[model samples]
Each structure stands twice: as C-alpha cells, then as structure tokens.
Target: MTTFDDRENAFENKFARDEEFQFKVTARRNKLVGLWAAEKMGLTPEEADAYAKSVVQADFEEAGDEDVIRKLLGDITSAGVETDDAAIRAALDAKLVEARRQFIEEA
Candidate 1:
C-alpha cells in the first residue's frame, strides 16, 4: 500500500530531481498562495486573479515567498488594502484551506 507519507516523500524526491516539475509546482503553488494572499486582503476577484498572476511572475523571477509576499503587500498598499500582514496571512491560510476543500469536493 502507498502510505500518504511515502507518496509525499516520493514527490519530494521527484521535486528535488526534476527541474520541470519544480517549476510547475512553484508556479502552481505560488499562484494558489497569491490567490490566498489577495482574498486575505479582501481584494475583488479580479484583483485577486491579478495578484495570482503577479505571484506566479515573481516565482518565475526566482523570488522567494517572502519577496512575493512583500510584492503583494506593496501592490495592495498602492491599491489601498487596509489589512495588516498577520490578518492577511491568517485569512489567506483559511481561504486556501476552504478553497482546497471546495476543489476536492468538485473533484
């Protein structure tokens, strides 16, 4: 039987070995993180999608999550989003969890 941990570790090993998959995972997860970030800051869906694009772009630029986050906050600041990082990150984590739930249900 394939245990969850075994599957996760296999993926981890594959990630370390496969540049293409690494890029794909980075792009996908960063976009998801960006969507989470945007909703956390209460952006409209359009703005959130824009933020997700930005996050993916940032990842393409080889920036870390913190840099992507900093960029996101900067954009939100320029756009006048009011929530602080703690609130936004927390809301994002919650939203991400909910989104995953919805996605799994849909699947």
Candidate 2:
C-alpha cells in the first residue's frame, strides 16, 4: 500500500479502537453507578448485579448519558430512596473516572 493509504488505515483503526474503549468505559461507569444506586436502595448483592446490568442496557435507549441518568433517577425515586439529580450526576462523574482508571489498568 502507498504511504497515504497506510496513514488512512492507521487513522481508521485508531478511531475504531477509541470508540470501543469509550463504549467499555461507559458500560463500566453505568455498572458502577447502578451498584451505588442499588446500595442506596438496599438491594441484595445478586439484585445489585442484575440492576447494574439493567442500567447498562438502559444506555442503549439513547445516544448519550441522559437516558442512563434518567433511568437511574427514576429507579431511585421509584424505590423510595432519597436522592437528587445533582447527587446522581456527581456519582456518574465519579464512576466515569473510576471506570477510566480501571480500563487503563486493564490495558
């Protein structure tokens, strides 16, 4: 292949890898947030895991984090747990940091 073709291929590969990494990070963050919410709602260990998976799946409902955030907020309130949007957003941020750290370590 020509140098130009090689460069294009490399860029495409990098983009793909970056997208995959982001997906993993988001999924991990969702799971972490789900676990935190679960604990707040007094869920058992098994229930927490299931809830986390559901949170992960909830992300597929939309293109951004809003869907996941909405799901968590609704679930938390529905469970009669006391929490605000700001707290949930803070948790989401914290979990994203943790998820990125874990992902980097795994790499």
Candidate 3:
C-alpha cells in the first residue's frame, strides 16, 4: 500500500480506539449515576439495578453527562419521589463544569 494509504489506516484505527474508550468511560459514569439516582429515590436493589441500566441505555443515544444527569433528576421527580432537586442539581452542575475543564485540558 502507498504511504498515504497506510497513514489513513493508522488514523482510522486511532479514531476507532478513541471512540471506544470514550464510550466505555461514559457508560461507567452513567452506571454510577444510576446507582446514585436509585438511592436518592429510595429504590430497592433490583429497582436500582434496572434503573441504572436504563439510565446508561438512554445515555447511549449520545446524551452528554449533564443532559443525562438532568434527565435522571427529572425522572426521580416524575416518579413521585421526594428527592432534593437542589442538591442533585448542584452536584450535576459541578460535575458538568469539571467535565468541561477536562475536555479543555485534553484539547
């Protein structure tokens, strides 16, 4: 193969690896969020597991961390649970800010 073709292949592989790594990290974060949401909502273990999986699945649709966090908060409220929205909001907002900072640093 030409040198240009080899370079293109290498770039493609790097891009794919980067995407896969990001996906795994995002999934792990979503799982933790799910567990937290369930605890906040006073859900049982089975319910918490299911809820976490659902949260991660929803996030798989390209929703960013902040968006997922907001939605999870809303979901807890919609379930008629007495959760501290202000606390959750603050936590999510702080996390969002950190994520942005990390992205900037990486860039």
Candidate 4:
C-alpha cells in the first residue's frame, strides 16, 4: 500500500482503539458509581452488584451520561437518600478517576 494509505489505516485503527478504550473506561466508571450509590441506598452486597449492572445498562439509553445520572438521582431519592445533581456528578468524576487508575494499574 501507498504511504498515504498506510497512514490513513493507522489513524483509523488508533481511532477505533481509542473509542473502545473510552467505552471500557466509561463502563467501569458507571459500575463504580453504581456501587457507590447502592451503598448510599443501603443495598445488600448481591443487590449492589445487580444495581451496578443496571447503572451500566442505563448508559446505553442515551448519547451522554445524563441517562445514568437520571437513574441514580431517581433511585437514590426514591430510597430516601438526600442527594443532589452536584453530588452525583462529583461521584461520576471521582469514579472515573478511580476507573482510569484501575486500568493503568492493570496495564
């Protein structure tokens, strides 16, 4: 293949890898955040695991993190937890950092 074609292919591969990496990181973050919320809601260990999976699934509902945030907000409130959007957003940010750290450690 021509040099230009090879460079294009390399870029495409890099883009795909980056997208996959981001997806994994976001999913991990969602799971972590879900567990955190579950603890706040006073869920049992088994229930927390299922709730975390549900939080990851919630992300697939929309293009952004709003879906997960909405689910957490609704559930936490329904469970009688006093929380706000800012708190949830902060948890997301913190868990994202933790997720990235876990990935780095694994690597």
**Model 3 CA lDDT for position 74:** 86
Q: Using lDDT, give the best candidate's number.
A: 4
lDDT of each candidate versus the true structure:
0.68, 0.95, 0.73, 0.99
RMSD for all candidates, in order, please.
6.8, 0.9, 5.5, 0.8
If scored against the real structure, what TM-score would every candidate get? 0.51, 0.96, 0.66, 0.98
TM-score of 4: 0.98
Write the residue-wise lDDT of candidate 2 on 7-103 in tens digits.
9999999999999999999999999999999999999999999999999999999998899889999999999998888999999999999999998
**Which tens-of-lDDT digit does each residue in 1-104 have in candidate 4?**
69999999999999999999999999999999999999999999999999999999999999999999999999999999999999999999999999999998
Runs in model 4 deviating more than 4 A are none
What's the CA error at residue 2 for candidate 3, in Å? 2.5
Off by over 4 Å in 3: 61-67, 79-107
Q: Residue 50 of candidate 3: its Cα lDDT?
A: 95
Tens digit of lDDT per residue, candidate 1, span 4-104?
A: 88999999988786876445555666677777667757889998898799877875555555666667677667767675667546644664565556545
Ranking by TM-score: 4, 2, 3, 1
For model 1 the local lDDT of residue 14 reads 86
Clashes of each: 0, 0, 0, 0
